[model samples]
Target: MQFRRTVIALLTLATFGTPATAEGEKAGAFDYYVLALSWSPNWCLREGDARGAPECAEGAARGWGLHGLWPQNERGWPSFCRTNARSPSRSDTAAETDIYGSSGLAWHQWKKHGTCSGLSSAAYYDLAREAYSAVTRPVVFRALDQDIRLPAGVVEEAFLKSNPDLDPDMITVTCKANQIQEVRICLTKDLIPRRCGTDVIRDCTADRALFTPLR
Candidate 1:
């Protein structure tokens, strides 16, 4: 298991170059978090390779799950810090595999974003899971019961209604080829509602998007 985690860690490094900070410097500490909740049905259907992804498996049918809790700045974000950090803690690896629905996904997010947060692997994952739980999903799922297609604005509004504390600016809907893919919600490090920067608001250029029924 350690060998596999090491391989995954090195592979991630190859993709995102190693950070230049001193060995003793803090890593992954950032301004805010972008809790991205992916719509599983869209991923399973549109991205065929991820068809049998556990997050969207028949028995689970998880409507939306944590894609990642990324560290972001006012302009951009941090990544690939602590070039030598090991894989997520064994405890986090086990718990997050179920929460993230894939061991690789859990490991990748921690390697990419978690290391930069300057938190221990366990604390980082605790925050990630807490962030996931802090945001309620029933409202969106309640509205998406059937196989229906709707404008992207409606989905955003539903989230706002469900989470009354959020403003129109705090959340954004992402779509691919008019299919709703994910909902990006902005929050402070302490998990309070936050407004995303203007530079990174929405993903889809489309005014309308489809919502495939949850599997």
Candidate 2:
């Protein structure tokens, strides 16, 4: 009886190694990476009120905050790959919260995107922070002294100007209604800037998108 129970247990373990790990065997299997940066003011507006958001309140008008570093392929992307699902280690506390601008965002990103990177949680997040550091925020985002609206092309130009190596094809601008929502840039697996496939680009159709200044 004991032997039969043990055999059944072994079969179960073999059938389902681990929920997260089972999917992880293919982690880091991607063609490129997309680093998305959210425009803070617009994000706050979408969420409801800037008065309640930490990134927007108390004079904390951080122009751009990381959305995520997603691993992608030329055709489609993989998600929720495998992971231990453990929390970020002690050393990654700041990057997981402060650098990401929110602990919740950090957690979600790690589970959704970072897990697919095939990197340890700390390493994946550190890579994301590094990717964010590589991007030069466009001058327009530096300080919006007043509310302004500009063509999507103008915004793309700003990014190109700030990053000499970046071409229009490398940056994809997304907007929500009339507000600029996020800016996504393509990069190589090693985090070097690269030209992304046209299909992966999701540009906003708005003729002019509003750029809200820090509150």
- Which has the greatest TM-score? 2
Question: RMSD of candidate 2 to the true fold?
Answer: 9.8
Q: How well is each residue in 1-215 modelled by candidate 1, as lDDT tens digits?
A: 99999999999976555332222235855678889988777777776335555666665665777889887776567787763455676666767866676777888888878888878777888899998888877555645567777777777777888889888888888888778888898889898989986645754656556677666
lDDT of 2 by residue, 40-60 (tens): 877887882634657767477
Question: Which parts of model 1 have CA positions greater than 4 angstroms off?
Answer: 1-26, 48-51, 83-86, 89-91, 140-146, 203-205
Off by over 4 Å in 2: 1-25, 48-51, 84-86, 89-94
Of candidate 1, the 10-residue stretch with the lowest lDDT total is 17-26
CA lDDT, every model vs. true structure: 0.75, 0.78
RMSD, one per candidate, in order: 9.9, 9.8
| lDDT for 16 (candidate 1) | 53
Name the lDDT of candidate 2.
Answer: 0.78
